[model samples]
Target: MSGLGDLVARLLGRSRAPVVVEDPPPTAEQIADAVRDVEARIEGRVPAAVTARVHRITGTVEDMVPRLDRFGVGDRQAYTVVATATSYLPEAVEGYLRLPRDFADRRVVSRGKTSLMLLCDQLDLLAVTLEKISDAVYRADAQALVAHGQFLADTFGQSSLDHPGPGAP
Candidate 1:
């Protein structure tokens, strides 16, 4: 039966396993460039609120690139950084920008909120999420620092407390 199935697949020019082609995950530099492009795309085109939130998100993204190793290439945070740069942030801004300013800011699109209001909410969410990622990265680094400090103290039997100031006897 297995041989018959393989014969049928071969006759149809197919394979036993479906081919899956997934794009390689974006690198830190690619993510950085993408976020920068998003920022540039929205510059002077959006209101102050949108611009401010974008800045907040971009700033965290910039800070996160140097520490991306904390999350590793395949981590969710890494995916998020890439998505925010390549898709999420750009889509949100462009969706709003595509609307006429007066209509976007004035017309209630959903939940009794205008497009501008909705965009602000989206931007705020992105900013907070990126901030949380940044905090997590730093927290990991801080833990590593503490461990290294403890290792030094244990190995040397000395700590900064053991060193006296110049005025000490």
Candidate 2:
């Protein structure tokens, strides 16, 4: 017998046909349901303490970053951090926020808005979820934002770090 036949015979202990099974492709509703499940899991995981920490971190950012008027950010545009948060969250958040509808084709730019929002949203979600899971809360301080910014600058560069001021590259 050929090697292939011999191997098959040995494995099967006789000549048995292999069974095949096919799974149906997921539908759009199924996909949406899965996404909703994931969102619910995330929401359930986040705790009150984590929410507070995230709130504090956001407050810190608000305090450190100049107001849009002070920085001359356009009224037509959303704040960088808010944009970033929206972008960073699942695309669902952006869709929910109706950003495309609101902003139209104005080109908000990733660095200008999406990235910052995403970072803040992700950090806040993680902190909240983890604290909820563990039943423990940890408060973050303004120093944490400074440290995070410094770390980003060190890792990337001053040019890459998102600073809310004119001439910030």
Following a full C-alpha superposition, what root-mean-square deviation does model 1 have from the true structure? 4.7
In model 2, how large is the Cα lDDT of residue 67? 29
TM-score of each: 0.83, 0.22
How many backbone collisions does model 2 have?
12
Candidate 2 residue 54 Cα shift, in angstroms, is: 1.8
C-alpha lDDT of all candidate models, in order? 0.87, 0.43
Q: Write the per-residue lDDT of candidate 2 for residues 1-169, one digit (tens) a residue.
A: 6778968986877755565677553433443344344355335333444335444434433332332333234422223333322333334333433444344224455656553344445566644543332221112345567889999879987673355778656
Cα-based RMSD of candidate 2: 21.5
Lowest summed lDDT across 10 adjacent residues in model 2 is found at: 130-139
Tens digit of per-residue lDDT, candidate 1, span 29-87: 88889889988888888889899999898888888887777665578987787688889
